[model samples]
Every structure is written in structure tokens, then in C-alpha cells.
Target: MIIQKVSDAVSIKRSVESGTEEQRSVVKAIIDDVRTRGDEAVKEYTEKFDRTSLSSYLVSAEEVEEAYERVDAELVDIIREAAANIQSFHEKQLHNSWMTTEKNGTILGQKITPLDSVGVYVPGGLAAYPSSVLMNVLPAKVAGVERIVMVSPPGQNGKLPAAVLVAAKEAGVKEIYKVGGAQAIAALAYGTDTIKPVDKIVGPGNIYVALAKREVFGDVDIDMIAGPSEIAILADSTARANEVAADLLSQAEHDERACSVLVTTSETLAEEVASEVLRQLEELPRKEIASKSIQDFGAIYVANSMDEAINTINQLAPEHLEIIVENAMGYIGQIKHAGAIFIGRFSPEPVGDYFAGPNHVLPTNGTARFSSPLNVEDFQKKSSLIVYSEQALRENKDKIAAFARLEGLEAHARAVEERFKS
Candidate 1:
């Protein structure tokens, strides 16, 4: 069972901020090795870590076609529908190249351009999920990224999962490699003979992948250092105990470190939900993982009032938040921090995770306080546009020079003054 005391909030926050020194050292070594050795390092690491050897790293066209044949026709249709929903939602986030001219002939705006290419790292092992393929690839595709390079570890059979390959093909991924872990990230950051360097890398992975992303951030942009999945439900007396318990378990099953929190004003509801979570855990296939997550990081806060519950939610700043109280929409304005807010009991987190049209690749580990979910903006680069007419330049040159000189850069001041010379 989860902790009941309010002070457990501190423990929850601490649990999310985890990265050992040994993990960093190992990831750094892998990154440096890949930087120097290129495909050779990648190959060696793939054999050592993934326990699969291959003559070639690239997934062939025949393999992709076979994947389509292998997966069930019904699931294929559902993936296509999910792809359509994702594309529709992300298209709305697309930004147009905009500019404006002032009366003084100064043109200022932003030019939004999509990155040339992006590498998506889909975790293999027990964490492989086809939904991640759709979430990472669709946004880049919608933003007009020309090339989408996908990398995932081969299973024991030396092949990518059929469902994952089918999803990548459905999402318009043109290039794919059967390699994973930190080595794939390094190859993406610094080009290998087989895998060309990409402008940015996106998707979720294990700790090694997360650390590798952190290490190579300066070389190539990354989506975010995503943490374990978490959910915080702010329910009141009206909320159903079983539904809330099931929702909490939804995220808890993601990993042993995943967190599930419930903040409610009703003590009786808390007791009911706690009992339901234990009862339901027995039937889940991933009960061992979920149980460990609950015992370590899960919690329920018995707030005295709705105000206290809102405070608790903001303090936690959970990745996925469910507000099941009365007039859920009415409390939306009051919620200050959360990656995604599921407003009613009917709107569970899975709805957002799958066919709900919103991007499910969200900020985790309380990053919702400042960052945002992955959207079209993540794939697009913005440049400030400034064009000053001769008159405008003449009017502002002295002021610009004065400001530059104040910063002890005489060359900057002189450059502006030289432009006005006779």
C-alpha cells in the first residue's frame, strides 16, 4: 500500500530526481567510444548489451513488408486510425513563417523551419510499445521533417517487433535501424557509416538512453530527459473508488519506479480506493512491477479541503493528472502545473495515451512546471527576423553603439558606427 501521510510528498519528489554516478560514467564511456569508433563501437555494444549479432544494422524493406503481414489486420487498422488522430492534432500546432513591418520600415518576426532530419529511439526489451512509435514519428512528420530515422533493439530473434515495425511504417518512417540503447543515441548524434547524423533525437528509453541523451545534448538536440511515468488523481467524494484505483495502476505498471498519487478530501473514499488497489493488483499481469512501484513511491493525500488538494497537486506537478471532482472544468483555471490534465472520470489517461488526438509524449518528473508536451514546435527551429531600413538604422545606430560600448565591446560599437560612415 502507498504512504498516507502528507509529508510523503517530499519523498515522491526525491524519488524522481534519481541518476547514479555509476550510470553516468557508463553512459559517458559508451558515448565517447561511439564518437571515436562510429559503427564499430555501435556494433560491439549492440552485441554486448542486446545479445544479438547482425551483419547489417538497417531494417530492410522486406522486413517492413513482412511486419505488415505479421500483425493482425484489426490492430493495423487501429494504428492507422491513431496515426490519423495524432496527425490531425499536431497539424494544429504547426507554425507559419510570419513577419510584420512597422511604419519606420523595420521588419521583425520569426521564421519557423522544420529540422532536416530526426532520429527516434524506441526502447526495446520489456518496455517496447508501438504507441511510442506513433507519438514520436507523427509530430516530426507533421512538422515536415524530411527524414525520420528510427532505432530499436532487435529481440532475441534478431528482428524488430512486428507491431513496432508496422507502426513505424504507418507513421511514415523511411529509415530504420535494428540497434538500440546508448549506442543508437551516440550514432544519431555523431554520424556512423550506416546511420547518418540527425538534427535531433526523440522518444523514450531506459536510464542508459536518458543519460546518453544528456551527454550528447550539445551535439544534437533531444526531446527531454524523461523520467518514470507518474499519475496524480485529485478526486472528491463523488469519484468512484475502483476507477481511481485502476487509473493509478495504469501508470504504476510502467516501471518499478513509477509513481501513483491520489489527493482527495474524503477519508472514506481514500480507504475505499486503497482497498480497491490491492484487490485489483492481484489480477494484473504486471502486478509485481506495479506493486513495487506502489510500495516505493505511491501515495494518497487526505486533504482537508479542495484548496489543500489543489495545493498538493501543484506541489507534485505530476505528469498525468486526473481531476475527478465536481465541476472538473471549473477547476481547470486553478491548476497551475501538470503535463496533461484529464478533466472528468470518463476521460482516463489511456484515452490521451492512445486515440485522443493529443500528443502523449509529455514532460515527466515534475517538469510540467516549466516544460511542455512534445508538439510540432519541438521539431521546428525558430529564427528571429530583423530588417532595418537605412532611415531606421541611422535613427538607432548611435543608441545601439552606446549600448554595445557599455558592454566593453568596442568592435561591436565601431561596426554599427562604420555602417553610417560617409
Candidate 2:
């Protein structure tokens, strides 16, 4: 990892990627084909990309049970516990539909309603992200979204991972499809012969999948276009070098474009963490990938003071941030950005990623400046509730008409005034 002065944050601003023209053209063609030919197009693309052929895409209950058998019983138990934790956390975020009556007899409030349906696309390739299954599905379940459908690319053998199946079963997902890539996104956005279109789509995928999500966004809601994973650790001299290095590497192993950076007040700690990162990178299973990530995007900044370090972090607006300073809790109010904040050394980024109960689906790039993590609210719609008494409407009708007229909406003004005329 290279060391730099904190003023050099320009180099660390961001590197969000948009798909190439070729990729976008490919995604558009697939989405159009899926819209035109439906299930047939999905299967054709699945065979081309995943090298698997299937008469049916839905995973059967029998196959789910078989998946449980293939996966270790102990891991299944862990998935259940993780699901429970996620459910419990999101349940706290749930708000009921409410209405309130004022002294004037006007009833007003907001109605909270879950989406009619949702589709979650899980990427399948070098690894199985059962955690993603739990993360995406459990929140929708907690928000009371019905018909949560899951789709993942099947292996060359035409099977989703046992752990993924087990996780979905545990998360209460009834519909699982063996389709992925841009085609799956298309099927989810527009109804296919087999897959019903959903109100919203959420999950992470490759550039093709990301582009597909972007293309279909106006028709159906989507989670943000997730860029590579990012972790920014703000440490002080009190922070342990090895632990900081390890936490940074955790995100690096996710992708070659993943970013890991450390901003610290202590010069010695900066040098030590830089050394520790390289030393630990040698031991990672995804060393080649992590090494490249660290080499290309990782850095250490020696700030003149802790305040400078914190300011630099806010400017970056990282997706995941860890404050390992001496008085970490005291700095919470000062943090203006970050999708998720891990305070102190005890709470590593992975804790929130898996067992800790926060959604791992977060805004990437500098979007944390204005966006948020996936939550129960994302799966629910808010409708303004109004039960206007005749007296209340009578009092406000003129003002409402005048306001509408000010906007040059004559019909809107008449709509409000008509209630009062004669």
C-alpha cells in the first residue's frame, strides 16, 4: 500500500464504473429479447452464459430439501440464526399505517404498504453468497412483501449452490429461479412466461447485471448500481495495526476493484498498517485478487491530526467506515457520510456484512453522501392518507385553488373549487 498526505484525497475520491458501450448494447438487446420472447430468450441466454440447459427454471421443493441434505447441518443452523437476527432487526424498523384526527375533524396520516412483489438477483460464479440471500430476502419479509422471488445463475451443472438454496428456504423464499445475468434482470423487470414481473428488483451482480438494472430502472424500482466494495478505516495511534490491516483486506478480497484505505493521525501507525497489509495479503486465499486491489486502489494517509483524518473520510463518503480511534463513540455525530459506520475495533465490517444484522446492501461510490442502506422502508410504499371533512375542505378549498392556478393548472383549480360551487 502506498502512503500519502491527507491532502491527496483527490486520488481517493472515487472510481465508479459505467458499463462499456458494448456491454450496454448487449444488455439492451437481452432486455428487449426477454420482453419479446419471454422465457425462451431467458433460457437461451442462460445456456450461452451459464452453459446450462433446463426445461424448467424454478427450483422445486424437493430440490430445496436435497440442498439441505448436501449442506452441513451446522451451517444450516447458522443460517437460521442469521435469518432470525436479520428479521428481528428489521422488525424494529417497521412502522404501521397510521392516521390522526385534528380538532377540525380532518384525518391525515400516511399508509405504509408493502410492495406487491419483489425480485432479488443473486450472482453465482466463483462463490456462493448465501449471506446475500438472507440480507435481501429477510428485509422484504420483515416489511411484509409477498411473493419475494430469488434468481441466481446456475452452475455449469445447472444447479444453484446448496448453501444458497438452504439460505433461501430458511429466509422463507418460496420462488427460486435458476436464471441470472442480464436475462434474469429482464425477466424480473418484465414478466416472462414463467417469471412474474416484480414491483422492485434488488441485488448485486456483474457489469452486465448492473447495466440491466440501470436499463430497467424506470419501469421497476432497483437498488443502487453497486460499484465495487469499499472500506475506509479511520484510526489513531491507539489502534492496532494488524487488526486494521485485516479489516481492510476483508473488503479487498471481494473484487479486484474493491478499495481499502486507512486515514490515521499517527505516522507510525500509518507505516505499520501499510507493512501489515502486505504481510497479511500473502496469506489470503484470494491473494491475487486482493493484492491487485490493494496495489491499484489501496492507500494510507498520514493526517496531521485526527480532525483532518475525519474530515477526509467525510469527503470520501465511503460505503463502509470504521473508526478505530481512542474515543470512537464520541465521533459519531461528526461523521456526516458513510452507509454504515463501525465504531471501535470490536465491530469489524464483516460483522455487519453477515451475523451482525445490518443490511450488507449499501450505497456504493460517493452515494453514501445522500443515500442509505437497503432496509424495510425500501420494500414498502408510503401513501398519504387524507380524510378531509367538508368543513376542512371548505376552509382550504380557495387557497388550494389559488395555489393550483398559480401553477397554471386550471383543471386542478377547478377540481378543488367545484366542491364548493353551488
Candidate 3:
């Protein structure tokens, strides 16, 4: 159904909720088991879920070499080129430690420090993609993380996909494990006999993986409890219906629950894009997935004007937003929420997903309103640097003591007073 007004758009329920309670319980049980049993639990869960038994969980150097042989040389070169682009884009985001000295001898700033290690979870089996390896690993590598550990489910043959291995290797990932699902997340959070615990975990996975991340949040840092992928296209009469339809399908094909939306000022364009979606959906190889997604979560909203369109976009806060209006760049400032805004018609959603330098692991399910796209900062920590001279300390001691005493923190007041006792 096409919505003709903003008020009507509000009433249409979007299926954007997280995992079910039963799924969460199952994930929690697995996590707790792994936390207690370590490799034993991981082995049991891997065999049960992945339908394979593994002697060793680590992806050995021999396996990585064999994976390279199995993959075509051309694909390897493309992954490397993409890696270079990702590295270049993230390099621009690297923040350095800085300190500022004042005349009163107070020095304050922040010290930038990369996490000691990180675990990257790559979805395996049918969902395995080399692009995921590149997107998840490159940022950690760019942030100067020393140890990069990766995990993916082994196939029924008990082997990691060659393309995934090649991508991980190209992205500078040093360690790889055969385990996946909630158990993989568990091993990363609480180290097993073989797998050492990492400081943080980052990547995309299914509902169980999302639940696992949520369960293990405090034990180890996670990128985000990522929801299903989503996209919104803000288009006008000038935008091509075919291009808009293709862009919407790109996200819809990822998952059946993925949201594909179009908010346009032109009702004619809205109807044209909806028809175009149906035409293209028939041609897609993943037509079953894409078609179901469009029928279930897809929407076309006709706004009164461009201002109304922009307002609707902000409310949705889609993981990916494509602005295909007459002056796409000019509308950028009006977009208050969106994980990544793709300006102009040529910049499709996949460009950000695979080729473009921006991280594809983005905030989803209205999270773009507050959170951000995964970047080098996710793999790093910052500590406030404060070096106060005697003069500075004395000058601020009275105020500090007064504030502390007001909060009933006498100990805190006394600590400051002790420094000035002499």
C-alpha cells in the first residue's frame, strides 16, 4: 500500500523489533554454557547448529594457503583494491593523542589507544561474503589493533569458504576460527582453552548472533546489536524509477525482514517506483527473499513537498538513505538521522556496502538517531589526560571541595583538602 500523507505513514507498523524472547533465552543459555565449559560448549553448539564436527577450531596457515589456491586470482585482486579504499577512508578518521599546555601549568587532552585484540564474526554457510571480512577487519587493522581474530562457521565439509579466507587474509586478519553462532561470540568474550578472549567483538550475523552480542555486552565490547538491514530512498520526479527500484531491492534481498522504503514528493514517481519494484523483483536471483521483504516491510510514502519528505526520512532513521532528488547534495544538511546517506542516483546502497570507503556495518532500526557507523574509533579507547600543576590545583581546590561536599562526598572533599594541607 502506498501512503499518501505523513500522518498515514505513522500508522503503518514497521517490523523492526529485535530477536524473540525464545531466541534470546536460547542465546543466553548457549553463552552461559560456553562461559562455563569453554571449548566443550563451543564444540557442542557448532556441531549442533553448523551440522559438523571439528577436531580443531582454528583456521590454520595451511588452510588459509589452500583457500587462496581455491579462490580465483581476479577476486583476490578486487578484494585487495577494496581493502585499499577502506584503509584510505578510515585513515582519514584516525585520531591522535594530543595535549594542550596552559599558562597556569594545567595540561589536558586525550590519549588514543587501540584495543589489544578484537574478534570479527563473519556469517558463514549461505550468508558468507568476502565483503563482510573486508568491512569488519580493515577498520580494526587501520586503528592499529595488534591481534585480529576472525570466526566463521565451517561448511558441512568442515571447511571455511575460500573467498572468506582470502578476504580475511587480504584484510590483515591473523587468526581465524571455524566456530560460529552464539558459541563463537562466547569464545570471543570468555576465552576457551584454544581461543584467547579479545577486548572487543565486531561484525554482522543472524538473530542468534545478535542475541549473543547482547548477552555478552558487559563482558566484552561489541560493535552494536545490529538489527536487520534497511534502506530508504528519498526521490523526486527527476529520479529514475528503475534505479530507485533496484536500490530498494538491494537491501530487501539481504533479508526477508529488511525494510525498503521510498518517500517522494511526486505521487506519479511513487507509483512508478512501486511498479518498477515488482518488475525487478521477478528478475532477481534472490527473488523469494526480496519479494517477501518488499511485500512485508517495503513502503512508498508520498509527501506534500521536499520538506515533508526530509522530515519523514529523519523519523525513519534508516541504516542506509539514498537521496535521489534534483539537488541531492543540497538536501544532506536536512537529514538529521541515517547511518549513511547516499547522495545522488549513481551512489547506490551497494556502493557503501562493498566498494565505497565508508563502513557498511552501520546502525540499524532507528539507531542512526544516536549511534554511528562502525569506524576506527570502535576499535580504540580514549583516556582523558589531566596534568595539574600545584598552582592550578590550589586555584581549583576550593571549588572542587565545595562541589564534593554538596554531593555528600566528604572523602572526595578531604582528598582535595589533603593536597592543600601543606
Candidate 4:
């Protein structure tokens, strides 16, 4: 990893943008195939990529039961514990539609309604993540979403992961599908004969899935386009270099593209953390991938002060941020952008990923500046209510008419005028 002093590093623009031409073209192709070929296209893509053949895309009830038996009882208990925490946290975000009536017999209020149905995509290849299922489905359930449809790729045996199935059952998912990749996204967006169309889609997948979601966006709502996982650590002289190295490696192990950065004021701490990372990397199971990531996108910066470190962090807007300083609380309000903040050494990023009650699905690649972590609001819509009694309309008609006329919208003025013609 390259080490730079805060003053010497150049200000670089973010890597991801709205949509590149190649991305648009890929998305368009996926959308077109799904639109025209439908189920056939989905099946072909599944066979080609997932290496599994499925007679039916939907997972059967018997399959879910079998999955429970296949998984360890101990892991099942852990999943339930995690689900409860995730549910409790999201339940707090649930909003009720409310209204207020005036003496003039006019009522005005906003209505909060959950989407009728939503599709969640779970990546299923190489590794299975039951934690992702909990993070994605719990919020939708808290928002009272009517139907939760889950889609994941099948293994070589042409079956879903037992842990994934167990998590889905615990999360109250209505349906599970044995499909994955961009094809699964297409099936959800345009609706295969088997998989019903959804109002919105959530969860994470590979580049193909991301591109597919980008393709199907207008037809159905989607969570933010996730980039590679990233984490930034802001540590001081007092911080534990070993712990900082471990946290950085946790994110780097995600993929070769994942970014891990450390911004610290202590040169000694920087050298210690770097040495610790090299030592720990040798012991990691995914050492090859993590090593590549650290050699590439990973960075270590020795800032002049905490303020300079914070400024560098804001510029990066990493997906996960850890503040391991003596006064971590005092710096919380100063963090302007981060997908999630872990204050102090005890609060590692994995805690939030598994059981901390906060949603783990977060914006990536500097999107934290504008977007937010996934929550109940992602599955719900709000509509404004406006009411004007005759007295109220008459009282404000001239003002409204004048405003509309001033904007060259005579028809808008006419609509209000004709309503109160006397």
C-alpha cells in the first residue's frame, strides 16, 4: 500500500459515475433480452453462468424445510438472534400515515405506504452469505411490505444454500427462486412466467447484477448501485495497530477491488499497522484476494493532525469508517460523509454487518455524500395530501391565480378560477 502525507496526496475524482457508455449498452442489452425473450433468456443465462439446471425457478416449500434440516441447529439459532436485532432496529423506522382535519371540514395529511411487492437478489457463487438476507429483508418486513421475493443462484447440485434458505424463512420471505446473476434481475424486473414482477429490488450481486439493475431501473425501483466494498480507519497514536490492520483486512478480503485506507497522524502507528497487515495477511484464508486489493486500491496516509485526517476521510467517503482515537465521540459530528461510522475500537464493521441493528447495505464509491444506508424508507413511499375548502380556496384564489398568471400558466389560473366561478 502507498503511504502519503496528507499535504502531498493529489485530490482525485471518484471512480464511479452516473453511467458509462459501456455500462449503458450492457444494461440496455439485458433489458431488451428480458423484454423480448422473457423466461427463455433467463434460463439460458442461468445455465451458462451458474452451471445449474432448474426445472422451475421458484424454490418449493419442501426445499425450504429441507434446507433447515441441512443447516446446523447452532447456526440456525445464531441466524434467529441476528434477525431479531435487525428487525427491532428497522421497526423503529416504520412510519404510520397520519391526517389532521380543520374546522373548515378540510383534511390534510401525508400517507406512508409500503410497496406491494419487492424482489431481493442474493449473490450465490463461491460463497453464501446468510447475513445479507437478514440485512435486506428485515427492513422491508418492518415497513409492512406485502410480498418479499428472494432470488439466488443455485449450486452445482441445483439447490439453494441451506443457510440462505434458513435466513429467508426467518426473515419472512414469501418466495425463493433458484436463479442468480443478471438473469435473476431481469426476471424480477420484467416478470418471467414463473417469477412475478416486483415494485422494487434490493440486495447485492456481481458486476452483471449491478448492470442488470441499472437496466431495469425504470421498470422497477432499485437500491443504489453498489460498488466494491471499502473501509477507512481514522486512528491516532493511542490506537491499536493490530486491530486497525485487522479491520482494514476485513474489507480488503471482500474482493480484489475492495478498498482499505488508513488515515492516521502518527508515523510510528502507520509503520506498525503496515507491518501488522503484512503479518496478518499471511494467516487469512482469502490472503490472495486481500493482498491484491491492498497492493492496488489500499492506501495509508499520515496526516499532520486529526482535522487533516478527517478532511481526507470526507473526501474518500468510504463505505465503512472506523474512528479509533481517544476522543472518537467528539469527532462524530465532524464526519460529514460515511456510509456507516464505527466509533471506538469495540465497534468493528462486522458487528453492524451481522447484529448491530443498523442496516449493512450502504452506498459505496463516495456515494455516502448523497445517498444513505438501506432502511424502511427504501421500501416505502410517501404521498402528500392537500385540501382546500371553499372558504379557503376563495380566500386564496386571487393570490393563486396571480401566481399562475405571472408564470405564464393561464390554464393553471383558469382551473382555480373555474372552480370558484360565481
Pick the lDDT winner. 2
Question: Candidate 3: misplaced stretches above 4 Å?
Answer: 1-3
lDDT, candidate 3, 1-422, per-residue tens: 35566667655345654778899889889988998999999998888999999899888899999998998898888888998999999999999999999999999999999999999999987756989998989999999999999999899899999999999988988889999999999999999999999999999888899889888899899999887889999999999988988999999998898999999998888888888888998899999999888888888998988998899999999899999999889989999999999999789989888888899999988989999999999999999999999999999999999999999999999998998676
Q: Over the stretch 1-422, how does candidate 1's per-residue lDDT look in tens digits?
A: 65464644554642543469998999999989999999999989989988988999999999999998999999999999999999999999988999999888999999999999999999899655889999999999999999999999998678999999999999999899999998999999998999999999999988889989999998899999999998999999999999999999999998899989999988889999999999999999999999999988888888878988898899888889999999999999999999999999899999999998898888888889999999999999999999999889899999999999999999999998998788
lDDT of 4 by residue, 1-422 (tens): 66789898886323353466786676677668877888898888778877777788888899999999999999999999999999999999887899898887677999998899999999998899999999999999999899999999999899988999999999998699998877788889888788889999999988878888877888899997998899999999999999999999999899888889999999999999999999999999999999998998788999998999999999988899999999899999999999999999899999998988899999998889999999999999999998879987888889999999999999999999998676
**Which ranges of candidate 4 are over 4 A from the true structure?**
12-27, 101-106
| Comparing 1 and 4 on TM-score, the stronger one | 1
Ranking by TM-score: 2, 3, 1, 4
Model 1: runs farther than 4 Å from truth? Answer: 2-14
TM-scores for candidates 1 onward, in order: 0.97, 0.98, 0.97, 0.96
lDDT of each: 0.91, 0.93, 0.90, 0.90
lDDT of 2 by residue, 13-97 (tens): 4556697899899999999999999998998999999998998999999999999999998999999998899889989999999
lDDT of 3 at 110: 99
Worst 10 residues of 2 by lDDT: 8-17
| Model 4 C-alpha RMSD to native | 1.8
C-alpha lDDT of candidate 1 relative to the true structure: 0.91
